[model samples]
Target: MKLSYPVHDIDNRLLLPAGTELSGDVLEDLISSNHTTPSQTLPLLEHGSVRKDIVKFISQPPYQLIFPEKQDISKLLKQMEKVQFVLPFLRSLDYFKQYDFTTYNHLLNVFALSTLLAGDLIPDYEERIRESAAGPAHDFGKITVPLKILKKRTPLTRAERDILDHHTLAGYVLLSYYKKDPYSLTARVARDHHERNDGSGYPRGINLNDRMVEIVAVSDVYDALVSLRPYRPISYDKRSALEEIVGLAEQNKVSWDVVKALIAHSRTDKPHYQEVEIPSEKRGAPPPGNVYGIIAEETDADASGTSE
Candidate 1:
């Protein structure tokens, strides 16, 4: 008999003994969940410059781009198709929004933004999910980098910087065996995310091809600027982030088109998880049917009384 189990469900601090196997039923449950996520449709992009910014306005912040309900999958596929058509011009803009985003959220936004940028240039950018996943997950290896260094309010010693530099390599090894896409981007993005145009990047700046490395370069810097790094609190606003990216473009530090696309993306509602200084805020939150819709499936949080 097959046993069902959930890693998140079990929530045990320690793993079972190395050689010990789980009951068939428990193992089956975990494996099933791991393998059985409902297949989502490929996200579509009509314009390339900054899709997410518009998506925030049209779709609502709660709506997830890559993963949504099966009922919504068809819509996403259609959108992805649209993106293919207009992405050459539509940039993913991130200006400001109310949602609170953690590191993971920041990473996903950059990944999506960069993917949109690539899709504008490449027809089959969907295949770049492998690359997109790498864009954000690359820093997971920083588990050894110490939260202090990552979120530090002070300067770092050379020794601390050296120790922290191995995050990319560590991320690569961690994801190498993941059941999902191989740790393909883990090593590449993490290691090279820092490499610069003038061959000033770290981890053996091989001076990679301009085309291939541009995505990581732009995505990395954009996220860094927007994120509240250890030494800094409340990073740049979306517009400021866009300006910085453009500045890099002017220096030929990055492709002009890529910078333009990112600048466009900085217009997104949830841009970099920081709301721009404004006079007021939106009246109410979006419908629960958007992203937290999953909760409705489990707990019926969307009460019948709440009318459209």
Candidate 2:
């Protein structure tokens, strides 16, 4: 009988029940030949459940080892909140980059903040947990993208934007192959996270039914607000970031209720979203007294190695 691994985790560590090493190209081929989509997870698993050996592999080692930082993030919350913060993100981000999540801590931070805000939108804390995982992890496919392309000081050419947008689909491939369950929140996030309220979004212009995606979308907007990008130098302060998200709700990009809850979180100072303004598409600087700082170093082939 053929064994089934968690298709959602295909992009992470390679495992033929663990203790195996494969080159990147070969691993890509292995997954490509057997690519799965979130929509396919249920059918695949329904066809057969997770293999015991595969479960054994996922529960130990690299998953447990390379992810100490994610664990650190998880520890900040209590049991229910812990599930909301870690489990979903752990599964969703596996494909893009797996590590301690030390730098920016953007994905971890976004997941925690978004999930807490989104919990009431979805009933089962477990399902909400799945949504939390998919939230920041929606960008995992962008990991290998060259920093120059992402942070170009000038407007991105159509080609550049198109290439950058592929991260959504790339992320989809990463999550779908492992889980193959369309009903799962992580699957929905990968396939439809980029979708806009007015259908201007990319990959697929899906009008998703899940409220978790909407809740996560608000947090997604928040993370972009605080992050430093080449297109915009400063991200918004907490109050301004909250206002921007609220504006997005007025523009129909996110739900009004989600915006209200996020704003409350901002008042408490628990969230650290990226601080993007949907109307202006500009990032705001850090809110008052925020110790948060983001820096990038660029290397030019022609110039001497100075600070980027």
Candidate 3:
């Protein structure tokens, strides 16, 4: 594999330059170093440069990216700056590099969308900052899961499914261990983001009452739907993604207020509304049994098992 860009070691030392071809040994070494030293696997670029479209989408309030030509970008960058911790954590993971849905990028989009929605729901600066931090950290536990399972296109068996479902608790534990504030929103979000209002989410079947968790949950689903997965050939269109979210809201699985906030922020009805291209690896056929949908299968299975 050829390097798409220059990579940096944990100390910010240059390890490989752009276009450097990676042999089997070199690749293994790089992955090992990333696991041990916490370094970036992808080429280094200017901060706030990657995923411009996501920044563009969440350009309203608290999140701004200042550009000479486009001032709308200014807000998105400002919001990102509040949660700078996300970058290093993202850089340290080399496993996501082969997949279309890189954790780094997916978390960035989720963080941006969650914060944008947070701006509407949360008024306090401190609370909003907490939400910003929680957004990216929600999936941090997936680092513990094997890459093979994360990328598998086949339906996960019972054991694999159980392991996958534990990611929420794993993420929460990881964040709690490292975070100075024991009550940090980041840790809570990691634990509760998958929890639904209907009490059907994993790691806990309790209905979530926290506003921040609800916001991140909706954002997570929205991004996942629009992102290309290893199991799916193409990403869902914006309308389909929105529709799925709306359905969740209708079912009381997520907060309707959050969904409306996303709709308003998206402005998809506007003439200039544009959909960002979500990167995907397109690795294999769609997973059987539930079409590889994020929360649908679990919800359906739970629903079927319940007595009316």
Candidate 4:
């Protein structure tokens, strides 16, 4: 088959340009390859199903507390559907659905929460929509990490933890490459969501400045804290989760306004965003080591084992 568009790997390497003929052998190789978009679009996420899932998620607790109004939900749903048309986003979702359902579920939750929070934080409907694309693809870099590490039931060793932490950098590069835009909001969110405002977060440990990044960062942390993880023996209850987030705000690790927006949802009373007393001492991040070779250096023993 001839191609209408050029094909690139997740790293954005040009594998086959437009008008390249695909013999049967080439087609087979392409199908067997991971992280490469196929010549033709396969079945992407159905708009109806995604809309249904988003609606159901928001109807539940905590999410139900600060759900958007009817008009805003309609607008948000439309924008989400628009994201499915982006090849990289679609491919990333597809990959997660097939290989990592846990991340896929997390993706859907973050996708709904980030966009909902955006509606509250961002006044302009268009900007909210643009930022909506960031959530679904925020953890797209995890596709490079082995499933064994991601789904490990026990604690990770220092080396394994290092590799897991590299997902941020991996996602950042892959997202930027996927969109062919270095400064894309999705890529930035993937890169910076782990970042704290106090410079205590990972990868760069730089303070987060982007509002979109801030919104997703709060959503990502909240969901992770509240949801059950293999490493976490018990998921945090709603109030406890919010308290921890509020504490982070007190520590200047996250934006107060963004945190308040999240807190506002769980309450019937109007949320007031007053300055929480900042801590006298701020925590510092350690200098980053060379994680570029961590994954490549993994051994079979490490892959099959867990650590505390």
lDDT of each: 0.44, 0.48, 0.60, 0.67
lDDT of 3: 0.60
Which digits, one per residue and each the tens of the lDDT, describe model 1 over residues 1-308?
11111111111222222233334443344334443332232232332233454345223232232223445434433433432211100111111112223443455455555555665554566665444544444455554344544443444444445546655544433333222223245445655666667666666555645443577678777766665554555566555556666666666667666665554444444232223332222232222212210222212332331211
Model 2 ranges with Cα > 4 A deviation = 1-76, 79-104, 126-128, 180-183, 268-308
Sliding window of 10 residues with minimal summed lDDT for model 4 = 284-293
**Top candidate, metric lDDT:** 4
TM-scores of the candidates are: 0.51, 0.57, 0.66, 0.72
Candidate 1 stretches greater than 4 Å from native: 1-102, 177-183, 210-212, 266-308
Q: Using TM-score, rank the candidates from best to worst.
A: 4, 3, 2, 1
lDDT per residue for candidate 2 within 112-217, as digits (tens), equals 5565666545557653354455655566555434455554565555445555666665555454444433345665675566676766565656554467777767
RMSD from true fold, candidate 2: 12.8
lDDT over C-alpha atoms for residue 281 of model 1? 29
Candidate 2 or 1, higher lDDT: 2
